[model samples]
Target: MKAIFDDRQWHHDPKHFMANGKVLPSPEQPERITRLRHGAEAAGCDFIAPKDAGLGPIAALHSPEYVTFLKNIYTRWQRIEGAGEEVIPNIHPANRSDNYPKSAVGQAGFHQADTACPIGKGTWEAAYWSAQSAVTGADLLADGARAGYALCRPPGHHAYGDLAGGFCFLNNAGIAAERLRASGLRAAILDVDVHHGNGTQGIFYDRDDVLTVSIHADPARFYPFFWGHGNERGAGRGIGYNLNLPLARGTGDDAYLKVLDTALERVAAFGADVVVVALGLDAYVGDPFKGLAITTPGFGRIGAAIAGLGLPTLFVQEGGYLCDELGENLTAALTGFEGA
Candidate 1:
């Protein structure tokens, strides 16, 4: 499979994030690309730098104002007298429903959902390229490639249309799905990230063109503690189109595969023309999160089952922290899909 990536993605290396009420070194770092590159090479995948498709593809899913905020937030934050090294939101409006803040600080809180996504000097550029990679993959699929992989760093499923969170900024998977929809194909995004793909879910929450489904650790007691639940079916025309299958913490492969079977069944029933796998290896047993226990071999089985859907597929990288097995785990999934 063709793996789309750009070296610019490494520039947004964040140093820290807020966790456990303290600032700690960020797990989402530049080194992640090196391991992923090794794995892609081991799988015999060809690497291609993304051709710039510009803001049009991204604007298809994100709001114009929000996009502007992401591009200019860092510069705006620099003017603050005592701002930290990176721009992290400290204040959020009590009523997000009726008020929009004009201060850079207020805008930061408004646009960034949490401390997990910190905007630094190179964040915008890297995020821009990461999104372009996803768009390029969609272009490849639209032009007739049966499958492709977008090795997007600064992973995006956690980003909403107007909010950045969980190390995600631009909602790359959602942008790819929008590209598919513009081509008149019904598309579906199946997010297998350890955390719920709240951003992707919100983007298509009221639309019928793209079906969004996620299987992750239940949010009631997990990272994204607000959105993922069994009853969050889509609203209006989108009702019955969105599905969330939250599993218990410490669940393993057999249980994961079973839930996946049900997720795929929903995709088939939806009659989607293409599928975007929001691929995240964070579910691996060795990952730092430890929310799930999917082994290296288990990823192969997951990939094989997704391949069985028999539809055009785009694999978009989400989250997988540093580990000795990072490359091997990625290689296993691609190899599994190919063999299947």
Candidate 2:
């Protein structure tokens, strides 16, 4: 299998992450690429630097304003006297429907969904290349590869059309699905991340062409507390097109696999021509989040089961943090898919 990545993705080294009323180092670090790359290579994936797909593909799903904000926000924030090194939002509108603001502080709050996605000097470049990597993976599928992997760092599933959250900026999996859809294929995104793919769902919520499904920890008490409820199905023409399987906290492998079966069945019913797996290894038992208890070997089984769908698959990296088994789990997933 071919894996898509760009060295520039290592540039977005975030420094601040607020949790439990205290600030700490961000988990979305550059070391992630090193481990993931080693894992993909172990799985026999040949690495290829992604082409500069430019803003056209990214702009397909993200708003132009949001894209511009991500690109220039860091520098703009620097101009503010006594500004923190990173651009973190301190205020947000009561509702997003409120008028857009001109102040840098208000814009930061407008574009950043939460403090987790801090905009550093290198964020825009890294995010741009991470998205291009996903686009390149989709291109590989379009050109007839059976499967591809995109090692997207500072992962995406949590971003929205105009807001960044949970360490995500550009929704890589959503962008990949859009790329496939534009190529005249029916794309279904199966997000297996422990955190619900709120952004991906939001991006496709009003459209019916692409199907979105996520199996994640129930949001009632999870990091993304506002969305990911089972009843928050798609709206408009997309009604019945989105599926959310929110699992209980501490859900283990066997139960998780059962939920996955349901997710795949929905994808099958959607009559999808291709599947973009929003692969988040954070669901592993050893991951720091501890949302799900999927063992390292469970990842292999998960990969094989997704392969059972028998569709061209593109695995876009999501939310796996640092752990001894991080690289091993990724290797297991890719190899299991290939072996299946």
> For every model shown, what is its TM-score relative to the native structure?
0.98, 0.99
Residue 168 of candidate 2: its Cα lDDT?
Answer: 96
Q: For residues 1-340, write the lDDT of model 2, one tens digit per residue.
A: 9999888888998999988999999988899899999999999999999998789999998889998898888889999999999999999999989989999999999989999999999999999999999999999999999999999987999999999999999999999999999999999999999999999999999899999999999999997999899998899999999999999999998999999999999999999999999999999988999999999889999999999999999999998999999999999999989999
Model 1, 84-125: lDDT tens digits are: 889998887665585886899989989888888999999999
Lowest-sum lDDT 10-residue window in model 1: 92-101
Which ten-residue region of model 2 has the weakest summed lDDT?
A: 4-13
lDDT of each: 0.92, 0.94
TM-score of 2: 0.99
Candidate topping TM-score: 2
Off by over 4 Å in 1: none
